[model samples]
Target: MKRKCPKVKSLLLRLLLFRQTRPVFTEEEKTEFTRLYDRIIQDGGIAPYDSSYPKFRFLQYLSVTKPLLFHGSNYQGIEEFEPRRQTLFDGTYTDAVFSSADGIWPLFYAVLDRSGLTGNIRNGCIVSRRGERFYFFSLSVESEDRYPWTEGMIYVLPRDSFRQASEGKLYFDEWVSEKPVKPLFRLKVSPEDFVFLSRTTWHRSTEPLFKTYLLYKWRSKFGKRK
Candidate 1:
């Protein structure tokens, strides 16, 4: 759906923005998340995210504070995860094993099109407790005409081994570990499963992905206040 919040212009409008970048879920979402979390905790057999050979869809045990954490990458079967200085186009963070509370937030990384002009990829994943939605729009809308589909995986690791290092105002889902840590398991995902291109309604944003990020952050932090 095309949702438009008040422009981030006036100081009063800015007051509507919340400091926390992580998504703030609803009460019903909280209850549903708890149920899904408990069920996933009890079940078994969740693994892999190859873009070319996409397998089972990733489950949404979507939560930000639970013991389970996720890390997305193009590689697979990561026996041990070590920390490093992650440099991205948006910004960079210190050396640490990074992960997220939202299960699908990592999928963007897992199945990213590692092409030459990847900075403009249309693929978008919104990290929130309520389903952690994925935003995929038309390739020929206003910018590039081609989008690539690549292979990737999501590593599921235990949270006890790491500490929450969300120092910035726009990455509350991120978690960091200083020492090497192994994942509990991995899930394979593909574009078909991750981005349901058929019936989903999507919103297009020409604004930089970072601003789109701040948009979500604003929703997460202040949307809950009455």
Candidate 2:
């Protein structure tokens, strides 16, 4: 793996490293530059569905009436948040800290990880164009045999540094800040509390990791045609 490639070989071979887009996501946000955040949110981890429970009340509490802004992650003890360049195309186009007015949206990032999976997991969260909230989760056969559950954390940030990033027309409810900010509170969220994962359209792909990256690049290139 230490071998060096000749310039010819390197150029002829589409290593695709520089070709990958680099968006300034939050520090703990783990994703390929070519991959979609929505795809990552749901396709990022393996989770179990709660057939016994009929509702996700905590998620509802977070999404509906929770005040202040919210950010979620798989890591803990993040005392400070630095502004990074996030070009999400959701209209939050600046170097800044990002969070959502609705807590449930941040939960999508909190409750998922690729810790032991050999392949992608089935998962996603969405608020419909019609205002319906939804989420879903399932594991690949290999993942099911390897890991049992998903773990994540939710951090509540002070809103003094935040500003509405997107217009209210789409009702996206996204917020951003160009300066560094610190969390006022952090909580370890249970997978059961994330029952909201079963809500929106789930995005799942079991392709090998390399293949998925190439596929994402291909799509990004072709989808940009005028």
lDDT of 2 by residue, 19-103 (tens): 1111223322222211322333344232223223222333233334334577878887677889887764343357888787554
Candidate 1 local lDDT, 1-226, one digit each (tens): 1232222222222343322243565566566555644565565335312223222222343444556778878787678888888733245657888887654446767775555432333333332333323333222123234454567777778888777654322224567788898877666666655543332221234555444434543333343210
lDDT (C-alpha, whole model) for all candidates: 0.51, 0.49
All candidates: TM-score: 0.53, 0.49
Candidate 2: TM-score? Answer: 0.49
Candidate closest to the true structure, highest lDDT: 1
What is the alpha-carbon lDDT for the whole of candidate 1? 0.51
lDDT of 2 at 121: 49
Model 1 stretches with alpha carbons more than 4 Å out: 1-59, 62-66, 88-92, 118-146, 167-171, 196-226
